[model samples]
Target chain A: MSAQGQELQRQGLERPGLQLQAQVARSDFVLDVHIAQPRGRVLAIVGPNGSGKSSLLQVVAGLVSSAQGIVVVDGDTWMNEDTFTSAEKRSVGMVFQDYLLFPHLSVQENISFGLRSRGSSRAHARATTADWLGRFGIAHLAERKPRQLSGGQSQRVALARALVTQPAVLLLDEPLAALDAQTRVSVRAEMRSHLSQFCGVTLLVTHDPIEAMVLADDICVLDQGSVVQCGTVADVTRHPATEYVAKLMGLNLVSGIATAGTVALDSGGQLVTTNSDLTGAVLATLRPSAIAVHRQPPQSSARNAWEGVIRDMEHLGDRVRLDMEARPSVVVDVTSQSVVELGLQPGQQVWLSVKATEIDVFKAHDEA
Target chain B: MTTAATRSPRRSRRSKPPWVLAIPAIIALAFLLIPLAGLLMATPWTSVGELLIDPVTQQALRLSLATSLLAAGCALILGVPLAWVLARVQFPGRPLVRALVLLPLVLPPVVGGTALLTALGRRGIVGAPLESLFGITLPFTPAAVVIAETFVALPFLVLSVEGALRAMDTRYEEAAVTLGASRMRVFWRITVPLMAPAVVAGTTLAWARALGEFGATITFAGNFPGRTQTVPLAVYTLLETNREAAIALSVVLLAVCVLVLVILREQWLRPGALRS
Candidate 1:
């Protein structure tokens, strides 16, 4: 570690990383959140539209002055009741959702804007900007204006511009959401590598679960401007707190009460799971691909089976997803060949079976 | 696709515009153009060179160019910050302030000069103190001409710049602030550069309006040849005694107005021009 890093570590022994507790009240919506993350960790805020994910990021970056609460980053107080630092005074770097690069400036000029604004000498700023351009692998685009660049190139330039300042906190709001699918894949991988190398606190706001899973160390789920669940990515994906999260994670969630190895589903069905130690209230989730669909009732060794008419059928690339309206509604995914052989269609009666080991059960908490 | 492509031209040709609209449009065009045609016809084209080089004509053109350019400079310096405040700041009674800034656009130029006289004339409200404190007199001078021109031309620049500022995307400014740029730095490095086209358009408009100012100059500065008289005032003065010189000067002013229009069209009125 460098001397500054060592000094930060010494100061962080008492108060590490980031602690933010803020409430921003607009006319129609209110965002109240409390988040804490250790240094050198990435926290992904995932939620549906209008769930205050971006609002929370803005509050932390000091872009919203109406936010009332405390924000501490690396043992420094950025906002509180009596003192609210403006965004310009705070050491923060943010990539806005649209990659709002300066349209009139060349790529090199845009990257060096922050350094020049902070009173650095022109030669020093130019050298630093050149280093960032080389690091981001966009040195050839240094002379081009923003309009001449593609979406992926713009994203790279925006990232290079934000990171060239070397702020303590890096906030990315849907950084890859603007690119096309093919470009997004490559840019996302590049972003992951860069983010891994950054020695700072990162807060990523995205609605894509795959992005959150691949990029974030921890997941924070928000719904209706409030935190629904906060845990490690594995913990949150394995056991979701709400139906939204379960659907986002591509799982079928059923709420019920457990006794022994059986769970009395609240939606009027019984699910047998391998978690025999669970008692009282619990939430059980099973992957759609794990559930097998049958045209006729079979004497299979599966622990649970139910008969229902197919409510809807959706084609998803190589597989077809069927929504079955059974005692406890469930989604089942089957191969397209199987779908063709069985001639599955809406209103067709089908049998769904899942082995007991496929159902993951956990204790239920208060609803989000 | 081939049939549709072949049929499109005939289909468009068959859709002729209504005679009701075309007849009045032609009449309106003639009504606006006939006076310019008459002026071109009445000019003594053979002696136009001699008339243009006359002492009075030369003096008026020089003073007009110098004062109008100076007035444009003054407008740019004062109007841009006023426009920024009007567009970005959210103080109370902002609409009222904006209305007051734009009042000179609709008020008569002579009335604007009268207003300037009350406020800035010698022995006037603020002018009395200026004279006693600084030993300066502003009425009937070249400086008074510039002051008068700026008073009438300022509204054009302010209105144009304010509209552009409001239409600009503020996300770039927010991004700059997050990148550790102070508000002043952002204004200079980002906002000013982004609104460059509007600033250019506004300054040109102010310069043109200042060049054509006549009533305000005569009322506030008094028509002193070579000192306070601009092209428009020169044409008015020569109209009674020297009709041919007056016609020649009017033609020059007409040519300048056409040139301004051409420049504006090239910069902003192109079919698919992108301002920023």
Candidate 2:
């Protein structure tokens, strides 16, 4: 076999991942982020708007000119205090939110741009570009400019362009955020298939919970420019440590001080939680489905109970959600039949109760 | 779309554009075009071809073409880099530097030519050394025609390209940089192509300005037949000796000017002005 064929066969035998530690200071916020994703893994970064998700991605791409950071991808140090590699030399591919396809160039030209920039001959770039255009299922769009493309097609072309370089690290900033709701579902599924086959470390930044949960194997929750929580999707959702993650997971979050099996809610209430590891300040998260409503004081053995008026009610899919005006403004999901039978109405006073074991308490972490 | 299609005609009639603004716009356009009309009226059409073939007229026409193209080339070579520096770089006195760059645009052409003399003439600051060491005197030369043309034409090119550069969506270059393109490659591949319309507009403006250059050329580079006399200088000199020849020459220049204005509106300025 030829030496080139041998070298091609030797690649992808094993792959390394990315390790990022960045301390970037922007005008509105400061990002103190540390994340590690194994090779062949898509780590999703879910954050609220202006929470420094893109800033972190920029730092990893080596685009931020002034930042204290060490970016290592596949055992190669791309940046540090004294030594820094420019974005062009770092072998990082980024997909911006708007796709940012060259409006002037056709699809093939856009994908071949990276290969051409790396000093490849035009014929070789054309061959490689043809392969990518087919892989992304945009072969029919090779001659069409960006304006002629649909939102989904533009996104696919963007992915093909970023992946054509075979970068060691991939940074995708809300890749599907610009798509309409109808297109986002199918495009996200297709993107999941493509991301699964990629061997490089991928950082996916998004504000949509469904996209994050559907695309990534692990989730990194960033809030106010810090990695507030990082864990498996199930771990972070089940025991959320911050209000932002709790909201993303649609769980009721209440912060307070914990003492002797009782946690004092910050908004003028108290809870007898089942948390054995409760300490000084803590945040208690409870699933809305865990709370039971009663017209009168219940004779059951539930630990935490409160009496409040219903502020409002919403009809969720297959269920009714009652927003009670209790301390911390708890939300409870009950059956539609139960709402009708109990005659639930706004401003109706009622007692709400939760079993002690249902509440999960964790240390409260205030944002910097 | 349907509403827009139906409403535009009615809207135009409801408030017949106020005569206050309409009258002035019409007067402004007529004021600019009346001189060309007069030139056309005076042009000796039957004798134009014969008169243009005269040796002096042919020499001036050829020199004008050669020198103007050269001046436009010089402006592009120097002005593009200067425009990039002015548009992208930030340092102290940047505002002052920009004001200085624009000073020549507002300066009188005669004054600019005189200034160029002190700076580059045979006995001038940098020109004296060339005369002593290299035996080169710049005045009354074709090179000086190009120099004077560049002086007046450069500001237009610099201003146009600088505006385009400032208005470019730099994210495209950022995307290229992330795709492993060096800064130079990004500037050439992404930045230049995106700025193509503006560059074309700027180059056309400079070329047209150079082709019609009069005061600066006559002041810096003396009229010496094929050596330095351009169409404008020849026209000015002809008016003193032969009125009919002068009118014919003016007719040629006016035709060229009309062609330039048409091309500017249809090709160079249209796309760049709309997008920018």
Candidate 3:
């Protein structure tokens, strides 16, 4: 450790990662969150619209002055009660949602803007910018303006512009949300590779679960200005904490009281799970694909069964998702061939059944 | 065929403006154009070259161009920062300051000259200390002409630039800052480039306004031939003694104003030109 790191440790503030505790109050919303992630890890902040996910990123980047927080990155304090570094002074880089590239500048000038503004010589800035342009496979586009570039090309330019500064903390807000579906797939793969090579701590704010799952190492679920859950991808995907997270993960979550092998669901239903040791308050998550739909009551070995009305049906490429209105409403996915065979339509009555072993049960948070 | 069918309604809608509006609009157009037509018709075209080469005409034209250009340059330097402050900063009494800055636009030019006199004249408030301290006299000089022109023309630049600054997307500046660009860098490299079209439009308007200034120049900077006399003041003076020269100068002023409007129409006034 360096002398500064030792001094930080002496002050009980040394941490080899990003530590942020922020509270921002507005007229209509208040965002309060505390997050810590190790260096070189990409933490994805996932939330619905107006969930303060972007506000958290802005606070960490020193763009929100009304926020009261302590942001320390790799043992360097960027913000504290007495010391508040502005965005320009902090070693941070951000790619905005719309990719706000300077429209007046060419791609080369746009990429070199950070270095030039920080007092780099013209030749030095040009050399570094050219290196980044070549690295991003956009060397031929160096003379083109932003408007002339495609959405995917613009995103790459924005990423290269942000990365060329070699910032200690990189903030990307909806990095791939602006691309079309066809472009998103290819760009997402490229983004994953670039993020894997990045040595800085990254905070990616996105609403898409697939983006989080494919890009980030851990996920932070935010709802209404508060973090509902924060954990690894596998843990959060297998066990979501709130209805929002459950819906985002495509699971039917139910609150219940567990005893032995049975759960008395709060939504006027009973669920039998294979977790025999679980007791007290718990959440049972059932994957949509795990539930089987039938025209008549199943006589098979499936344990839990319920009668439901098909409220709506949506086609998902090769599969069909049915919104079943049962005692505890749930979503079920079946093959399109099965849907055609059964002739499933809205307002049709059906039987839904799932195996006890397929239902994952876990203890709910005490406050929840 | 589909394109024509889809565009027919819009074409018909444009072809038939309401009669109530069309009548008054045509009348207004004729009302503005008739005088320009009369000026071109009444000018002594055969003697125009001789009159334009006269030493008095040359001096007045040179002085007018020099003063107006200097005034526009000064307005560009001072007014853009003022506009930036009005559009970006949040300070007490800013609205009042903006109103005061725009006061010269509506105030009579003679009244503006009088106001400038009270502040900068030799016998006036600050002028007394200025003379005692620096041995300077501002009134009835070429410097006074530029000052008066800048005073009356600055608001034109400020209003347009401030409007453009307000309409600009500040996200670009924020993005620059996050990329480690300082506030000054962002202003020069991002905000200014983004608002370039408006700046050009505003500077042109201010230059044209300064070029045509008569009441203020006559009042503050006394009309002395070849020294303080601009084209407009010279035209006023020559109308009594040399009617043909006055007509030729009026034609020159008319041609310059028309050229300014044409350039504005082609470049900055178009809808698409202002946008990125």
TM-score of each: 0.78, 0.77, 0.78
Chain A, model 2: TM? 0.66
Q: What proportion of the true contacts does each candidate reproduce?
A: 0.89, 0.79, 0.89
Candidate 3: where is the Cα deviation over 4 Å? A1-15, A118-124, A251-368, B1-14, B132-135, B271-276
**Order of models, best TM-score first:** 3, 1, 2
Query: What does candidate 2's lDDT look like per residue over B1-276, in tens digits?
Result: 999999998898777988988899999999988988888888899999899999999999999999999999999999999988988999899888888877778999889889888888988998999899999999879999999999999988888888888888788999999988988889888999887877887888899999989888888998898899999999989899877888898888777877877867854555556232
| DockQ-derived CAPRI band for the predicted complex in model 1 | medium
Worst 10 residues of 1 chain A by lDDT: A4-13
All candidates: interface RMSD? 1.0, 0.8, 0.8
DockQ of 1: 0.62
Cα lDDT tens digits for candidate 3, B130-239: 99999999999999999999999999999878888888889998999988888788878898889888898889989999999998888899899888899999999999
TM-score, cand. 3 vs. native? 0.78
* Residue pairs that clash (backbone atoms under 3 angstroms), model 2: none
Q: Which pairs of residues collide in model 1?
A: none
**Global lDDT of model 3:** 0.86
lDDT comparing candidate 2 with the true structure: 0.84
lDDT of 3 by residue, A123-202 (tens): 99999999988888999999999999999999999999999989888899999999998688668767877888899899
Give the candidates in order of DockQ, highest first: 3, 1, 2
Tens-digit per-residue lDDT, B26-100, candidate 1: 999999999999999999999999999999999999999999999999999999999989999999999999999
- Model 1 lDDT, full chain set: 0.85
Q: Whose DockQ is greatest here? A: 3
